[model samples]
Target: MCGIIGVFGNDNAGRLAAVGLFAEQHRGQESCGMAVSDGLLIRLHKKMGLVKEVFHEEQLNALPGKIAIGHVRYPTKGSATEFNTQPHLVETLSGPCYALASNGDIVNYAQVRKMLENEKVYFKSDNDAELLVKYIAYRILHYKENIGDAIRNLMRDIKGAYSSVLCTPTELYMFRDPYSIRPMIWGKTPEGTVIVASESCALDTLGVQDRKEVPPAGIIKVSDSKIEVLDNDPNLYREGNCEKHCIFEQIYFSRPDSFHFGENVYAVREKIGAALALQDEGLNPDLVVPVPDSSNFIGLGYANQNGIPLSLGLIRNHYIGRTFIKPEQAVRDESVRQKFNVLPNFFNGKRIVLIDDSIVRGTTIRKIVRLIKDAGAAEIHLRIGSPQIKHSCYYGIDTPTTEELIANRRTLEEIREITGVDSLKHLPLTDLKTCVHCPENYCYACFDGNYPVGVPDVYN
Candidate 1:
C-alpha cells in the first residue's frame, strides 16, 4: 500500500506536500518523494526512507513550484529500492509528464510489462508505477488528444484496483480505478488550492475545505483557474462493474479518524465488537485490552458494547520496525519482548479480553496471549475484529499463503489451543459485512474467497 498527495496553485507546494505526506506516513514508510513543477521544469526530490527522514527544510525549499506531488510508499508489489521510489517522472514526446503515486495492485502488470518488453520498451526499474506511466504515455502518444481523453482511453485497457494522481508541468490529474479498491479524495482549500490525497485526514491536516471523494473511474483535472470532471466511463457505477473494495482497509489499513463510505471507522469497529460479544455467549471478560495501536479502536468497540473496562495492558515500543531480521528463535523471542512490554498492573487478577484486528499466522497472537497469561490474568479471551483471513491477497496486501494462514487449517477451538488462550472467538464473516456500512462495496475475498476481480492464473 502507498499514500499519494498532489496540490495545484499553492505557493509553497513542496512544503505543503511534505505536511500532507507526513499525515499519511503510516500508509507507507519504505520510501518518500516529492516533485514540484516550476512551469517549465519538474524539480524532483526523492529518497529511500520515511517522509521525515527524506525531506527536510532545505530539501523542500530546493524543490520549488506552484504545483507539487508527493508519495510515501510501502513495498507490497515491488522490491524496496531507491529506483522503485515514486513520484515517477518520464519525458514523453509530447511533454514532460510525471505520475505522483498510485495505490492498489494491477493484476495485469505481468501481461502489460511483457507486451511492452516485446516492443523493446525498456524500463529503468521493476516498479509497477513505471509500467503504468508508460502505458498512459503510450495512450497519449497513440491518441494524440488532450490529457483527459488519453486517460479515459487508458482506463479501458487497464484492470485491477488503482487510485492514483498524475501531474504535468501545467496541470494536475487524479483518477480512481473502476473498482475503487483504494481510497482517493479531492478537496479545495479556502485559499483556492486544489488537493488530492489517499485519505481525507491529509486534507484535514492542511485545513483544506470543500472536500469530495474522487468518484470511481472518474477523472479530475486542475489547470490554473480551470477545474474539469471527465466521465467517459459511467458504467462503473451501473452495478456489478467490480468486486467489493478491499475490506481490510477498514479492519487494519485506514486510520481510525478516517471515514470509509460515509461510516466512521471507529464506529464500525465497535459494531464488530458488539457482534463478537453476541457470537461468543460463553466468554464474559472483566476488561478489554487491545494489542496496541491498530487494534485500539476495535478494542474500544468491544469494551463499550460489553460494558467492560478498557485498559492499556500492552505497551508497544514505537521504535521497532514492522519486521526485523533475527538469526535464531532466542533472538526472535527477545525482539518480541522488546517490541511490546506488558503493563502488569492492568492484567493483575483480571479476566482480560484481548482484542486484535486479525490473526494472520497466529505467531504474534500466540506470543501476546502468553505474555498476558503470565502477567496474572485469570483468563485470556481473544476476540478478532474481522473474520478469518483464509486466502492470500493479490490486490496489494502482503499476506501469507493459504497453507500459512492459521485459519485455513484450524478451527476456533484449535486456534485457541495453539495460542494457549483460555477461549477464542472470531468475528463471523456475515457480521464483517455489517462492520462497513457499504457491504456491497467491499471485497471480502480474503475472508470469504469471493474475488471481485478475476483470480490470477499463477495463484490458481
Candidate 2:
C-alpha cells in the first residue's frame, strides 16, 4: 500500500502537503513526491527518497501554490526507481498541468494499458498511478468530457482499488474506487484549508476539525468558489451492494492513532489480542512480549486478558522502515536484523508469549524468534494477530504469488517447526471477524480467497 494527500485553498499548500506526507511516512518509505498548483501552473517534484529528504524546506520554497497533491510509494505496480515515483503529471503543449496520486493497485492494468496504447496514448512509467492519470487525460482530451465525467467513466471501466487525488491548475478532486478497499478521509482545517488523505492521522496532524470518509464511488471537488460532493451508486460497480474494505488495514497497515472503516485501528488490534488470549485457556507465560510498534496494543490486550505482565522486551529501531513493506526480499531480510533487538537482561530463562501481527513469508518472524531464542529464553510461544494469509493480494499489498507465501507452502505444524517457536497459533478467521464492527463489510480474500472483485486475468 501507499499514502496520498491533497491540500486545497492553502497558500503554503506544498509545505502542508509535505507535513501530511511525513505523518504517513510509515505507509511508504521507498519514495515521496508532490505536485503544487498556483492557479496558473502545476509544478511537480518527486524523487527516490523519504518525504523529509525529498520535500525539504528549500524544495518546498521552489513550489508555490494554493493546491497540492502528494504520494509515498511502496512499489506494488513497478520496480523501485525514480521513474516510478508518483504524483504522475500530464503536460499538454501549454506546460505541466494535470497531476494525480493514488494508493492501491489496479488489477486490470495490462488490459487497460493496452487499450490506451492502441488509442496512441503513450506511457512513461509502469506504475498504476500513471495508468489512472493517463486514462483521465485521454477521456478529457478525446471524449471532450469534463473532469468529473472523465473520472466517472474511469470508475466504470477500471476494476480495482484506488483512493486517489487529482489536481488541475485551478481545482483539486478526491475519489475512491467503488469497492472502497482502501482508506480515504477528508476534512477542513480550522483555518479553512481543505485537506484529504489516505489516513485520518494526517488530517489530525493538520488540525482538521471535522472529518468524513470519501464515500464508496464518491468524488469530491474543491475549487476557490465551492466544494462539491458527487457520490455514485456503488452497487453498479461492485459485485455486492455492500462495501469490501481491505481487512488488513485494520489488522496491520493503519497507524494505531488513525481511525477508519468505522473502527479504531488500535481497538481492532486489541480485540484480536483478546481473541487469541481467549483461545489459550490455561497457558500462562511469564511475560507477554510484542514485536515492537504494531503489536504493542495487541500485546497489551493479551496481557490484560491473561493477567500477565506486559514487557517491552523487544526494542525496535525507529530508523529502519517496516521489514514487511521493504521492496525486495533481500532488503526485508536485512531490515529484520537491524529493525529489532531484545532488551538487555530480558528473556533470560523466562517463558514468553510473543505477539506479532502476522507471519507473511515466515522469514522476518523466524529470524525474530531466533533472536529471542539466542537471548537465553526458556520457551517462546508465538501468537499472531491475524489469520493465515494463504492467497496473494492484488488490491495494494505486495504478496504477488502463492508460492512466495509461507501458509500456501506449509501447514501450521510445519511452520511452527520452521520458525522454531515452542508453540504457534494464528488467530482464527472466524475469531478475526468478531474483532471488527461490520465484518461483512470487510474483505478477507487474503485468508479465505473470497475475492470481492474477481482476480485479474493474469492469475487465471
Candidate 3:
C-alpha cells in the first residue's frame, strides 16, 4: 500500500501536503511526489526517495499553488524507480491537466491497459496511478464527461482497492473503490482549507477538523465555490453490501495512532493481543517481549491479560526501514541485522514470550529468535497477533505469490521449527473476528483464501 494526500484552498499547499505525507511515511518509503496547481497550471515534482529527501524546503517552495495532491509509494504494481513514482500528471493540448495519486493496487491493470492501448492511449509508466489518471482523462476528453462522471465510470469498471485523490487546475477530488479495502479520510482545517489523506493521522497532523472517511464508492469534490460529497451505493459495484476493509491494516500497516474502518487501530491490535493470550491459558513466561514498534501494543495487551511484566528487550534502530517491505530477499536479510538488537543481560535464564504482528516469509522472526536464543533465553514462545497468512493479497499488500508465504509453504510445526522457537501459535481466524466491531465488514482473504474481490486470473 501507499499514502495519498490532497490539499485545497491553501497558498502553501505544497508545504502542507509535504507535512501530511511525512506523517504517512510509514505507509510507503520508496518514493514520494506532489502536484501543485495555482489555478492556471499544475506543477509536478516526484523523486525516488523518502518524503523528506524528495520534498525538501527548496522543492516545496518551487511548487507554489492553492491546490496540491501528493503520494508516498511502496512498489506494488510497478518496479521501484522514479518513473513509477506517483502523483502522475496528464497534460493535454486542449489545456485540461489532471494529476492523480492512489493507495491500492489494481487487479485488472493488464486487461484495462491493453484496452486503453487499443484505443491509442500512450503510456509512460506501468503504475496503477498512471492508468487511473489516463483512464479518467480519456473519458473527459472523448466522452465529454465531467471529472466526477469519469471517476464514477472508473469505479464501476476498475476492480481493485483504490483510495485516490485527483487534482486539476481549479479543483481537487477524492474517491475510493467499491470495497473500500483501503482507508481514505478527509476534513477541513479551521481556516477552511480542505484536506484528504489515506489515513486520519495525516489529516490530524495538518490541523484538519470534522474528519470523516471518504465513504465506500464515494466521491468528494472541493473547489473555491463549494464542497460536494457524492456518496454512491457500494453494493452496485461490489458483491455484498458490507464494506471489506483489509483486516491486515489493524494487525500491521497502519500507524496505531490512526483510526479507520469504524475502529481505533491500536485498540484492535490490543484486542488481537488479548485474543492471542486467551489461547495460551496454561503456559506462563517470565516476561512478554514484543519485536519492537508494530508489535508493542499487542505485547501490551498480552502482558496485561496474562499478568506478566512487559519488557522492551529488543531495541530497534530508527534509521532502518521495515524489513518486510524491502523489495529483495537479500536486502531484507541484511536489514534484519541492522534493524534490531537484544538488550544486554536481559534474556539470561528467562522464559520469554515473544510477540510479533505476523510472520509472512518467516525470515525476520527467525533471525529475531536466533538473537534471543544467543542471549541465553530459557525459552521463546512465539505468538502472532494475526492469523496465518496462507494466501496472496492482491488488493494492496505486496504478497503477490502464495509460495512466498511461510504458512503456505510449511505446516505449523514446521514453522515453529524453522523459527527456532520452543512453541508457536497464531491468533485464530474466529478469535480475530471477535476483536473487531464489525467482523463482517473486514476481509480475511489472506488467512482463509476467501477473496471478496476475485484475485487476478494469473493467480487463479
**Under the 3 Å rule for N, CA and C atoms, how many clashes does model 1 have?**
3
Clashes of each: 3, 0, 0
TM-score head-to-head 1 vs 2, winner:
2
- Note the Cα lDDT for every prediction shown: 0.79, 0.93, 0.92
> What would the per-residue lDDT of candidate 3 be over residues 1-460, giving only the tens digit for each residue?
7999999999999999999999999999899999999999999999998899998888888999999999998888888999999989999997579999999988888889998999999999999999999999999998989988899899888889999999999999999999899999999999999999988899889998789999999999898999998767788889868899999999999999999999999999899899999989989799999998999999999999999999999999987878887888999999999999999999999999999999999989999999999999999999999889998899988888888999988999999999999999999999999999999999999999998888875555
For model 1, the stretches where C-alpha displacement exceeds 4 angstroms are: 234-243, 321-336
- Scored by Cα lDDT, where does model 1 land? 0.79
- Model 1, TM vs. native: 0.93
TM-score of each: 0.93, 0.99, 0.99
Q: State candidate 3's TM-score.
A: 0.99
lDDT of 1 at 453: 69
